[model samples]
Structure formats: C-alpha cells, structure tokens
Target chain A: MPELRVDGVTKRFDKVLAVDNASFTASPGRILGLLGPNGAGKTTTIRMIAYITVPDTGQVLFGDKQVGPWSQKQMGYLPEERGLYRKMKVGEQLTYFGELKGLSHSEAVKRVKHWLDRFDASDWYGRKTNELSKGMQQKVQFVTAVLHDPELLILDEPFVGLDPINAEVLQDVIMELKEAGRTILFASHRMEQVEQLCDDICLISQGKIVVNGELREIKKSFGRNTILLDFEGPDGFLDDLESRQLVRINVRSKSHAEIRLLNDTRPRVVLDEALRHTHEISRFELVEPSMREIFVTAVTAQQGAEAIEV
Target chain B: MTNNIFIVAKYEFLKRVKTKWFVITTLLGPMALIAFIAIIGYVSISSLTSDDKTVAVLDATGILFDGLNDEDGQITFVVSNMPEDSVRKAVIRGVFDGYLLLDDQIISGSGEATYFSKDGGGASFFSRKLRNLVRSTVEERRLLEQHVPPEVFEILNARVDVNMVKLSDTGETTGGTEAFAVVGFIMGFLIYIAMFVYGTVVMQGVMQEKINRVVEIIVSSVRPFDLLMGKVLGIGAMGLLQMTFWAILIMAGVLLSGTVVAAFLDPATLNLPASASQDELLAAADFTIPSIEPAVFIWFVAFFLLGYLLYASLFSAIGSSVEQQQDAQSLMLPVMLPIILSIVFLQPLIEAPNSTLAIVLSMIPFTSPISMVVRFAITDIPFWEVSLSFLILVGSFIGSIWVASRIYRVGILMYGKKASFADLIRWARLS
Candidate 1:
C-alpha cells in the first residue's frame, strides 16, 4: 500500500486556488520531496497532509486508510511556524509534546533524552528554548517532529535556520528514517538538497504540480548531452553556439557557460564545435542537468505562459 | 469526549500555571495587593497619627484656642502672619491640605460665622471638627445673650439619646443603616474582583497562545472546543483558588486584629455621651450583626460560578478573536458593559438591600451573582427567585458556551482581520 495518498485534493483560499487539483502518493521507505517557490502551495499541501488543515475537496489517505479517520498520534508534522514554548525548558517541552502525540510519559522522556544526546545537546536539556540560537531551535523542532516515533513524518522547511553541519546532520537522520521504513516527506526550494535526498519528487508551482516523478527517472529523462564549458576568451561562443539546431544556452557568467542539447543533437558535434571555438577551453564536460537547472528551467518556462502585456 | 475535555483542561491548566509570566504574575498579584493594602493602611494610620494639617488662624474674633488642640494627636496650628494672598499661594503650593478662615465679623446677626476652607466641607474630619467649633462658639454667644451664665450653660447640657425605630406601612420594626446593604457591597466587590481577574487571565492566556502559535500545534492535537472550554474552566479554578487564598488571608487578618474585632462588638466603644445607661444603650443600638447562613454562601458559589462561566466564555471568545492587545480593547467594552451596568444600576440595591428594585435585579441572572448574594446574606432572599435565577443563570452559561465556542473556532484562525460586532452577530447566526 502507498504510505500516503493525497487524491484529487483541491483547496482554495477564497478566490485563490492554493492547492488546485493536486494529487500525489508516496510509499514507505521513500522520501517525496515537495518543491515550490515561495507562495507556491508547498506549505499548504503539507498543512493539509499534516492534518493541520482540511482540504476543501478531496481525501488524504494514510496507507490504505483515510487520514481523516486517523488519530493525531499517527502522523508527526513540523509546521513552518517553527515553534516550541519559548520560555519552556527544551527537554521538558519535547517530552510534553511527545506525550501529547500519544507516547507514554517515560517513553517521551526517554526519546527526548536520546534525541537530545544524538544531536550532542545533552548539556542544553534544562535550558529554555529562547536561550538557544535559531539553529539550535531548529534542531529541537526536528527532534520534536520525530520523538514520538511516528510512522509518517511531514516536515515543512525542516532544515531551515540550521547551519550547514546541522542541515547535513538532519539530512542524514532523514535518510536513516527512510531506511527504517518511515514515510518521510519534506518541503524545500533548494533543489540540490531535494535531488540528493528525495526518492520521489513532486514539484508544485502556483498551486499546481509542475513535475512529479521518481527523482532518478526524472533526472535520466532530462538527458545527459548538456555541457558546461568554462574557459577564457571573448565569450561570443554562446551567441555563435545559439544558432546551432539543437543547442540552448541559458544565462552565462564571465568564465563559464551552460548548454542544453536537444534530443536529436550528437555529442561528437558539440565536442567538435567546442574544440574549434576556443583553445582556452580549460573545462568542457558533458553533464546531466542539475536539479537547480531543471527547477529554474521548469519554473521560468512555466511562468512564461502566464506573462502579461507589461 | 469527556476524557478529551478533561485531558485538554488538565494540560491547559498545567501549561498556563507553568508559564513564567503566570508564575511571576501570580506571585506578584497577591504581593502587590497585600503591599498596596498595607501601604494604604500604614499611610492612613500615619496621617491620623502625624496630624499633617496646617491651620491658619485669622483671630478676627480672637476667641477660640481649643480648636487647634486635639490632646493626643500632633497638629500644627500656624497663626496667619501674612496677607490672605500668601495663604492662597501656600494652598496652591500644597503647603496645607486646607486652611480655616474664621471671620467672626458676622457674629452679631444671629451670631453668623463664616468659616472658609479650601474645597470646603467635603467629608474630611477636619471640616467636621471646624464646623463643631464654630457652632459651639455661636451657642456660647446665644447663651450669654440669655440670662444663663457660661458655667451654668456648660453644666446643663441637653444631649438627647436618639433611637432609631423604622416603621413599615403596617408598623413593623427594622434595623437602621441597612445592614444588608453592607453585605451587598462586600459581595458585589468580591464578584467584581473575581470576574475581572479571571476574565483578564483568560484573555491574556488566549493572547499568549495565539501569539506564540502554540494554538496551531495544540489544535492539531485537540478540538478547538476542547481547548476553549478547557481554558475557561482551568482559569476558573485558578480564580477560585486565589479567592480562597484571599478568604484565608482575610480570616488571618481578622484573627490578628483581635482588639479591632473587640471594638466592633463592645458596647463601651460606642463613644456616646457619658450619662447613657447600658439598658438605654442596648435599646439604642444603631447597628446589627449580619447573620451569615450556609444557604447564602451556597447561593454565592452557585451564582458566582454560573455568572463567571457566562462572562468568562465571552472573555475567552473576545481574546481568541483578536491578535493584538489594542484590538482586544475594542472588544472589551461591549463584554464589560453588562457587568458594569449591573454594578452601576444595582448600586441602589446595596443601599436599599431588600427594595423591590434590588429583589428584581437579583432575580435577573446578569446581575444576580452580586445582587443576589447581598440580599441572600442579610435578608431572606425568596427561594423561588434563588432557584429560578439560578436556573436561568445556568441556561445562560450553557448558551454562552455554545456561542463563545463558535466564536473561538473561527476567530482563532482569523489573522489580520478585524471582527466587528456585526461580524460576531453573523458568526453566531452562522454557527
């Protein structure tokens, strides 16, 4: 059974279709990355999934069962609000929240201590949340989301406000949860992180999914004929190369250029053209389109259709 | 559902109590109240002992010196040396609480005496004393005009021991000063304090939860109704606990001040004329001890809880509807107006404890908790109105809970939107 299935969901905030006809499913041991720009219905979708909100016109199912019938204890949701009791002790707050989510008091306490120590924050257990920095608070929030050992974890901006080290630490834990067969879904706009961590990706834009698929399959279908040529010269190579039948170059820097080739293009022709163009072609390598490129390409291309006269 | 309600309530109560602000404020509120009462008591006793009064004697008649001498207390009498302009300046500079101007020039025509004091004769004991002195002086002059000498006049005083006898239309006896009115005021003030404190606490708790976004997290766990009712009842318990502490404190105060209590019951402390006998004193007792029966207190608890729940629901609803403190202020006046109106209009009830208006108002559930408690305290408040008003009060409480719960549900999620009176009406109708 699918770990979670949000089918035919439609949520409108008044006249604004915040989540319009959106649907997706993720199986257990899989991470479904919900990606979108700011105000792109990512959080709203997560909110609906977390049971923080109800969808106006559809059903959210947990495994084979409808989520509406499930107890709050079944799912762990980290809202974008990113809060704990500001004046409460971190350890105490975690245990309280954990217990409220249906863990026994001792179990909650034990889980809190275990997670706190895992993050090397055992010394800060007694300290108030407000005493911690933003990154520390984010760590606390992450622990709160998982402390009850929920089968499903829905995190909205889970790695927000964390340092690079801590973000990676959280990413590792997320991967570990996947391996332990927990259905994990997190929202992020950083496409690289989603690409690295997500098994299935659902990219939402303007309250609609622009892309939804297995991450590896999506990357494979994106094609590998694209080349990033970083070299020294007058840089007219891009303009000259733009006239080619299957070449598309998007935004260039002073020393580097990215090129996407059409399905009909040959890699040998591109290599021949590259060698002929500039002798100072220090790094000319064929590369699969990065998720960042794919995101910018998809979102920009999507936005182009809705452009006004202005 | 019952389990959920109690679970929600227990957590809400524990959570609020554990809050730093609540803990600090709880400690601070009683400390401040006690310190304030003590400071007021100390200041009052000190002022009475200090005798911080400056008297200006014009000596226009130059006849009275005993006026300035209160044998036990310290009073400083300043004989006017400068013109009246200087006295005006001194008064404006707050150099004196007031100054007495004895212009005895008008003494010839029926011994008219003009005593000038700033803000004259407004409840101060000094003004009372000043009036007494002027009257005595005028009486002496009249006695002199007659054949009676000063020594004979002083010896043959006509001090009458006036006794009060209230007669109904059918000639029934009654106590003077309306002992029930005092009971009414005491109960009214207690209810006022309880309602105000608990309402404020409910408001602040809701505001804190909304501002902290803890409501969002908790709503995920529990229903909005559960949260709202839990909060209302939880704070209600806290308020009752505080009132209990106050009751204990008052009993302690009454115990420690045994001498003062003795003065209250002692017939010797009446301070009437020396010639009155104990039998006459007994016949002329001006005040009666208020009998407190268990029934009055039972009604008090019933009405207090019902009335508190009624208004507390509205308070919580108001608090949940608004985002900011300033926004909450606009919502307050409408909710507070009824209780305030009850306090204001039923004030006469405190004066005429068993008047028709007091009885009627006490029967009205809105005003019953306070007005009824007073009537129930001294008089025999009718059993019918007690049961009827209590029934209505409970009905109103249930009705308000329904309305307040509806308001809380929609209002909790409403942000950057000002809910007007009209909107509330619509919300109520819709819900």
Candidate 2:
C-alpha cells in the first residue's frame, strides 16, 4: 500500500479554493516533490495530508486507512513557518518535540544525540535554542520532524535557512531514509533541487497544479533543447543572422552575441552561422532547457500550454 | 491513557526543568524573595539608631518652654529667640519636621494654636504628638486650679484590664486564639494565589504553541492528552519547587532577621515616663510560631496541585484559539478576573464562610478553586463541599482537556490568523 495518498482533495480558505482537485500518492521508497511559488496550493495540500487541516471535500489516506481514522501519532510534519521556544535549551527542545512524536525519554535522548552527531551540532547540546545560529536551528527542526523515524515525512520548505553544505546533508539524509524504504514528501521553490532529489513532481501555480508526472517525463516534455553560443563580430552581425528558430537572444555585444535555438533546431546551425560571422567564437555548446525556464514558462504562461496537458 | 499521561508528564517535567528560563527563574525567584526581605530588614533596622528628631518651639508664652523636651529621641528644644517673623522662615528653611506655636492668650475657653510644616509633614505622628503635649500641659494647669492632687489624679487615669471571656450561659476564656487563627488563614491564602498565578501561565504557554502552529510538529508522534498532562505536571512541580525553596529561605531569613530585630529593639526599649508603672513585656520564649504547619504543608501540596490543574486547563483551552499575545490578553483577563475576584473577596469569606458570595463562588467551577481555598482557609469545610469542589474541579479539568484537544486538533494546523473564543465555544459544542 502507498504510505500516503491524497485523492481529489479540494480545500478552501473562505471564498478562495486553496487546493482544487489535488491528488497524489507516495509508496514506500519514493520522494515526491511538492513544487510551487508563493501563494500556490502546495502548502495547503501538504497541510491536508498532515492532518493539520481537513479538506473541504476529499480523502487523505495513510497506508490503507483514511487519514481521519488513523491515529495522530502516526505522522510527522514540519510546517513552513519555523518556531522553537527561544528560551528553551537545545536538548530540551528536541526532547519535547521528539517526545511529542511518541519517543520516550531514553529513545528521544538517543535519537537527539544521533541527529546532533549527524549535524555536527553535539557541542550545542546544552545551549539555548535562540543562542544557536540560523543553520543550527534548522537542523534541530529537521531532527524534530524525523525524531520518531516516521514512516512518512511531510516537510514544507525543508531546505529553508540551510547553507549549501547543509542542504546536501539534508538531501543525503532524505535519500538514506528513502533507501530504508520510507516515503518523503517535501515542498520546494528551488527547481534544480527538486529536479535532482524528487522522483515525482507536482508543479503548482496560482493555487493550481500546472504540471504533475514522473520527473523524467516532465523534463522530456519541456520541448526546448537550446544552446547558448557566445561568439563575436560587429554587434548586429549575429542579430541579423537568418536562424528562423531563434528561441531567445540573450546578450549581443561588439565582441560577442550569445544566441539560442528555439527547439531541437540544432546548435550546429547556430555554431555554423556564428562561424561564418566571426572567428572570435569563445564558446558554443548545446544546453537543455533548465527547470527554472520550464517553471517560469509553466507558471507565467498557464493559458498557452497549461502544464503540457498532463 | 494512563501510559500516555505518564509519557507526557515525564517529557513535560524534563523539558521544563532543562530550560534555562525555567532554571534561572526557579533559582531567581527565591533569591529575589530573599533580597527583598533583606532590603526591608535593612531599612527598618537602619531607621532605628541614636536618631535625632529636631523640633522648633516658637515659645511666645515665655513659660511654655518648661514643659517642652530637651535633646533626646524627643524633639530638640530649638527656642527661636528670633522675632515671630523668622519663626515660619526658620521652618521654611527646613530647620525641623514641624514647629509648635502657642496661642497669645492662655487658659481661655478656646486656645487657638497654629502649626507650620511642609504639605506631607503636616499630618505626621510627630506633629500630632506635639499637639497632644501642648493640650495636656494646658489641661494640667486647669486640673491644679481645681485643687486635685497630682498623685491622686494618677489613680483616676484612663486604664483597663478587662479579661476576654466567652459565655454561652456558662463562661470560658478563649483569649487571643482568634488572632492566631487569623494568621493561619492568611498563610493558607497566600500559597493558593501564588500557585494559581504561575500555574495558569503554564497552561497559557501550552495553548499558545497550539494556536501558533508550533505544536503541529510536536503532536504528530505525541498524543494530545500526554501533552496536556505534561505541561500541567511540569509547571505544577516547578511551582512547588519554587515555593519549597523560598519557604526554607524565608525561614532562614526570619531567624536571621529576628536576631537582628531583637538587638535593634533593645536600644529603643519603649517607655512612658509619666506612667505609674511600665507595661510588662510578654516573654519572647513563652511564644512559639510553627516551623511548618502540616495543614499548610498539605494544603500547599494538595490545593496547589489541584488548584493549578483546574485553572490551567481553562487557560490552555483559551490559549489554543488565540494566535497573538494581544488577543490572549483580552481573553486572559476574563479567566483570571474571576480567580482574582475570589482572592480579593477572601477576607469576607473568612469573616463568614457560608456568606452568599462565598457559597456562590465556591460552587462556581471557574471561581471555585480560589474561592474554595479562601473558604478552606478559615474553618474546616464540610467533606461534601470539599469533595464536590474536588469532584467538579477534577471533572472540569478533564472536560477542559477535551475542549482544548478539540481546538488543539484543529487549531495546531491553522496559521496567519486567530481563533476566537466564540470559535472555541462552537468547537466544544461540536461532537
């Protein structure tokens, strides 16, 4: 059975429908990326699955049971807005959060120490929470969410406040949990991180999912294999070139005019045209349409393509 | 449920005890209490020395200076030989606490005298004492004119030795016992108020977390009931620890202060030179104050535990719905106001334990914990009322947990908004 599932979930905040007909599933050993810009339905959907709020009309299932029937102790959720008792000690705060997750004193202590060691924060065991740096506090929060070794983890903006090194550490921990066959669902606005970490992706925009599918399929259907060619001549020498499939013209200068192909119209043509124009070809290579471009195009131009029809 | 409660209580105690805020406050409270007592002790002690009080005497009558005092703790005889114009001037220059003036005419039907001092100093005890001295001196001359012997006059002085006797057809003495009982009542009341205040704060803390979306991460693996029990027990324990430590410190401070006070009182040994005989001192060794009364100890432990749990449950529920500190303030007043009102009216309840207000507030679940403590302080309460209150408080304590959990179950997930008291009422009414 899938460890977690949400089906046709619709949630409204007053007159505004925050999550409209949202649906997803995560079996064990999988990572699902809940991707969206601010004001998107990702948080609303995640909150429903976490049982913090119920959907107006729909079902959330954990294992084969409806989320309503499942015990509250069976899940772990780290909300987007971070909070910890500023005056509480680090160990004490974790224990309180850990014990809230159903770990006993001994169990919570062991787990806290283990996570503290993993984050290289054992030195801060006796320190108060507010005394710690932002990155350290984030690690404590992450530890709290998984303290019980939850079967399914719902993390809203998990990478928030994390430095690059710590972000990678979090990714490694998520993967390790995934290797141990736990389901992970995390929300992120960072497109590359989602592309790298998540097996399945749900991209939302304006309280609606613009795209939802396997990560590989979504990348495949973006339909733009473009290359940036940075070569130079007189400025308008490349601008006046006859490449009918020019997707975008990024930078055109006296020494350089970077050009991109619209589709799989071949970087060779862009290079060939550039070669005929100038000997100052500094760099030219094929580049896939980035996830950021896909996201921007998907969110901004919903009326045109509407999430590639799936 | 029992297991869940233990788990929560254990975690709550552990979490609170380990907090630097808790540790510092726990230690800081006793220290503050000690320091406060010490400062008051020092001020009172320092005030008692070979202190001099200067008195300005504008003796216009020429012979009134014979009855006035010399330089002692008594007023110094500052015979202002200067003209009457500089008398008020001398006072204005801060020469004395106040000045006494004699009327130009003596032994008239009405002898009018003027007193001069700063605004706050006018009604002072020293000024009053001086005025009394002048009146008595004038009265003594009148008594001498009536040919009354001074020694015989002493026999007719205002004095009494009426024995306190209680009679209900038969007479029996119950001297000063009511005064001692009043002391017990005050002690009982102080403990209850202190516990209720701090314990309610604990409940508020729990509720704020639920309302603020801080508890969602906490409650996933932890049961709601455990969280509730944990906070109550943890805070209740902290209160007890604080009281116990402060009590010990106060005991030590009292003994230390008592010795110092005794030595300080030795020099200023109270006396009246005009009296036939000095009033006898009640032997200090004959009296005893309890080191720790078992009833007070039991009330402190039992009532504090029960009272705090009862009040805190409602606080926790109120906290669950309100998201911000400002909103909590308005809601908090309604809940706390009843407890405070009960405490304020405690003296009346002590005067008559079965008074209508006492009976009404003691029965009211919201006001009962504090009201019952006030009622319990004065006299032995009937088992039924005590049990009824305990029963009602325990039941409401449980019911409020249910109410809070309903709000907690729903409220913990809510963000960017507040839940109203009416919203909580609706939730409580929901199945």
Candidate 3:
C-alpha cells in the first residue's frame, strides 16, 4: 500500500478558515489518530484528504499522484455523518457503493457477502437499511468502506453511537486491516481508543495543527511526571499536596488518583507524603502523560496562545 | 469518471423503476384518462337524447300547416284546430311541451311567432325546432305563389358543408385544422405535465440524498457533476419510458375503437340525398382517421428532452440548497414561474399558431418546449424557426446545467441554514 500524504492543505468556507496549512502523512500498515476538539477543523481536513472537497491551497497526494478522482478509486471513506439509502436493501446498497469505488459487479457482490457474513449480519442482506437497528446499519456502513478493498481507509468518528461490543468488533477488524498493510486514518473523541490503537497522532486546534508525531514519542516528550495512586484511604493527602502546589491532580476517586507533579517536584517526595497519610499503598507508579491529557493540554495551550495574540 | 456516472445512473434508474408507484402510474394513468373521457362523452350524448318533447301548433294562417311534418323524431308537432286560448291552456295542462302560434302576417315574411312552454326559453331545442319548421313552411308557400320551382327552392335552402384542410408550404393538403388543434393541444399538455412531474421527481431525489447525507459518501467516490448528470439522465429516461408506454397504449386503443366502429356501422344505411356523388357519400359514411405526421411526435420528444433537462437541473440545484421541503418553496417559485407561464401560453399559441405572440413565445427556450411543439402541430412552422427554437433550447439546457452543477457542488455538503437565491448565486460563482 502506498503512503497517504496531505501537504500544507488549507480550506476556507466563506469568512471562516476551516483548515489552515494542515500537513500530515499516514504510512502503510499503521493507524493515524486525528485528534481535535469540536469545531477544530478535523472533519474539514479529513474531507480534503478523502477527496470529497478540494483544498483552497496545497495538495493531498497518494504515492506521487495528486489526490483526485483517480486517487479516490483507491480510497475508502466513511464520512462523519453516516447514512445509507433508507429504502435500499443492505446488500444492494453496499454493492452499489463498492461499484462506485471501481469494483466489478461480481467482485463487489462477493465482498459484500463476505463482509456481511464476517459481521454475522448475513441475515440483513435482503432487509431495507431502515429496517435494521442503528448498530446494524453501522456494520453495513463499515462494510461499504472496505468492500472495494481500497489501500487507504478514512473513518471519521467511526465508533460514535456504537455499543461497546460492536465497537470492539469494529476495532478488531480495523486491527486486522492494519495487519494486512492497509493505511487507516480515523478521527474520534474517544481518547482511550486513540491511545490504544494509533501508531501516530495529529492534534488540531483552531484550524491549526499543534502537535504531530508518533504517539509514544509525543507521550515521552511530556516525561514521566504523572503518578498513579491506588489506595484505600481518606484521600486527604491529595488535597494537601494540591494546596501546597506540590502536585496537580489529573484524576481522582475514592481510592485512585492520577497526580501530575508541579514545579519539577519529585514523585518520591509525593509518595513519601502519601505514605505518611496512609500505610496501605496498593499501587504507585510513575508513568508518561496519557493521550487524553496530552490532547487537552495541547488544545488548551493553543487556544490560550491565540487568545493572547488576539 | 464516465463509468461512475453510468453506475450512479443505473442505480438511480433501477431504484425508481422497481417501485410499485411506478408500475401503478405507468399502467393505469392512461386508462384512467380514457375512462374519464368516455364518461363525459356518454353523459353529454345521453342528456341530449333523453328528453322527448311535443308541441301543439295553432296555425292562424291555414297554409302554414300544409307541408309541415308532424314528427321529426325528437319533437312531435301536432296541427291542432283548437283556438289559441285552448292551445295555451293545453300547454299549461301538460298536453304539450309548448304551443307555436302563427298568423297570416307570416306569409308576408314580416310575421312574429311565439312558442310558449313550461321553461319559456327561446334557446330550448324544442322551440328552435318548431321555429325552423314554421319559417321553412311559410317561405315555401310564398315561393309557390310566385310559381318558383320546388327543386330550386330546395337548393336555395340547402345547408352547405365546409371541409377545412390545412395547406402546407409545399402546397400539399394535410389533416383538418380541428385534428391539428386537438393533437397540438394534447401534445402540449402532456409535455407541460411531464415537465412538472419529472422535474419535481428530480428535485425530491436530490433532497433525499442530501437529507440522508448519502451524498457525502457518494461525492467522495465521484464528481458532484457526474452524480447530478447521472440522476437527471436516469430519471429522465424513466419518464421517457412511461410516456412511450402510454403512447403505445393510446395507439392500440384508437385502433381497437376504430375496428369496433367500422364493424357496427354500415355505409348503405346512412341517410344521404339522392344527388350525393359516390365519393361524397363514402366520405360522409366512412370514419376518416386523422393521421398525425411523424415529425410532430419527433418534435414532441425533442422538446420534451430539452425542456426536462433544463428544468431538472434547476430543480436539483434548488433541492440541494435547502434542508427541508418547505424551505424550497421560495426558490421553487422562480423556477416554477416559467413552466406555469408556458402552460398559460399554450391555449393562445394553439389558437393562433402563426400569430406574433405564438412565434415569439415559441422562440424563447423557457416557453418553447411546449409552445413550439404546439405551433408545429397546428401549422407548418418554417424549418428555420423550428431549428432555431431547438438550438436555443439545447443551448439553454447546457447553460443551466453548468450553473446548477456549480450550485449543487457547494450546496449538497452545506447544512444548518436555509439557503437563499443570493447564496445560490454566490455558490455558482465559487471555484
């Protein structure tokens, strides 16, 4: 599979700059997580890469060729707004979508049947799309994206509105596709899923990319400054630490907390203080910043910089 | 790229063609129209013959009743010796439908006769029949008094029949003017209806895709222009198919009815005057089927295709611009106005196909689809004018598709706000 590259693309809608000088690339046999807050230009950038809309400036290329109708033939796209022809049967609708992507009739049909059987939804082949549940429709939608077996697959918010079981099923298929050397670019608000599945990540805020690198390296840059605390105690030591400006509590519950050290404070110092408050320390570990924390910190910092500039 | 267009077209075409509604409308629509016409004809004919009327005549001038027949099938005329007062009384007593009173002054041809009935209307069929009988009898008596021959008088009073034949530019006589008008009106009306029905179908189809957001995925796979063309061509083909089916059924119906009429009616039994020649006799007795020129049908199809393409593109543009059906009404008014105006012009254009109003309307592309076909059917339009109208229609279609596709490319992905004409114009100008 060829690599997908978006080189310095910009898009403007009327007075709004929907996407600004966005650049990124996803290699074959890897998943690129496009992370952003609401209205952060993720969908716009994805749309340009999917060849659904043209960029106002720059270009998107597949291998050495510019993204166009020809490039679109080898691209699979599942848009943010999911839909199927409500009156059309699932099998026929998928077949139509497959053929639209340049598959022969028999090949499209064979793949549609294969995907339907793989998802345990073969019984829904003859049923109208509207007759199926939302999750069922979602399975069929996923099949459409992969039925033509394009080299690159772009899924925007694919797991949205899916039950955990269905989401897991979809995640496993995505893994299998990645294993088969196909490129996958997906955008989602579920930070944990991105943290688990993405090999590389791009974070956009206010129509600008604030961070783009391998997920592990990006997390490593934040350093192992966060401490995970798991203990059965009153948890009063956390408040004491926060009030004294020794640590910032990223997460807290009755018996668990993720604390970020402030002002270059040592994890040993915080752990010694916690031991004094309670003798029962079930778990304590120093770990790098999570993708969720990295996303929030990066987007907030970008917005703060923009605020100051404005 | 063209392959994707065909794929989309095939999908759209099959999607609708397989619907139950398509089957019902294609098969039953013409049958319903035929049934409706049959009912109207039967009602009018039955109403005319159902009423039997009798009138009593009190001929104050005795010679008025000399040669007058008593019964003429529909109305019975009784030559009564009763006085005028008794005749009026009998009419009121329901003995007659009316009473016709004649006097001596009728012989001098300045007399006035009065027919009294329960309705007391001069326009009644019975009264008109009685008046004609009395006047003819009086005139004959006066002519006899002058020693004029009865044969000459009969010839003088005979009704003349005029056969209207349209002379084309080539000096060849074609069908009758009435037949041309009927065919023209039917053709114009059908095209007018098709423009609205199929144009709205295209609009609704686009709106459905936009609302469903299926367009987003489809556009990713194909150019927006290709998708738009595919849909327009697909639905247009379906409309053409339905029309062709209707045309065949109508032709079969005409042939069947002609056979039935021929089997039922014998030429020898038809009432004819002794002086009638064999040719005139046969012409009257035979039901001459008016032959519509093939060019009329060909032009009908050409105009329909051009007109549908022009309007369908505009409709699809409007469809993509709005999020809901009600939001489309404001935009629809402008597109609908030209089609409505075309229909309004149909009557006048058919009435005077050679008039300047007809000529000008038929030349304009917006109104030409219906108007030009009607004018061609009613008269022998100059070949240059026909070709010019067709060229203009094709040109406008191309222009509209270009503009509409631009708007559609931007509009289909846009949501949240109801788009206005200004927005559409801006979108059209967008790269």
DockQ of each: 0.37, 0.34, 0.71
Q: CA lDDT, every prediction?
A: 0.73, 0.68, 0.86
TM-score of 2: 0.76
Query: Each model: TM-score of chain B?
Result: 0.74, 0.77, 0.82
**Worst lDDT 10-window in candidate 3 chain A:** A301-310
Best by TM-score: 3
> On a 0 to 100 scale, what is the lDDT of residue A258 in model 1?
80
Local accuracy of candidate 1 as per-residue lDDT tens digits, B1-431:
44446655666677667767666765576677678878988988754443456666555656554444544443456667577778867876778655666565634543344445566646556556666655676566556667686679757675666554444333534464364455556567678776777788888888778877777766666667878887888888877866777667655654555444444444555665656654445445544444445687788778778878888888888888888999889889977876787788655665676788877787777777777777666555568878988888888888888998888876776678887877676666642
Interface root-mean-square deviation of model 1 in angstroms is: 2.2
Question: Per-residue lDDT for B260-369 in model 3, tens only?
Answer: 66555555666766665555554665445557788888889999899999999999999999989999999999898988997888778877888999988898888899
lDDT value for model 2: 0.68
Global Cα lDDT for candidate 3: 0.86
Model 2 Cα RMSD, 1 decimal: 6.2
Scored against the true structure, residue A112 in model 2 reaches a CA lDDT of 91
Instruction: Tell me, by lDDT, which candidate is best.
Output: 3
Residue A66 CA error for candidate 2 (Å)?
A: 2.7
Question: What is model 1's DockQ versus the real complex?
Answer: 0.37
* Rank list by DockQ: 3, 1, 2
Task: Order the numbered candidates by TM-score, best leading.
Answer: 3, 1, 2
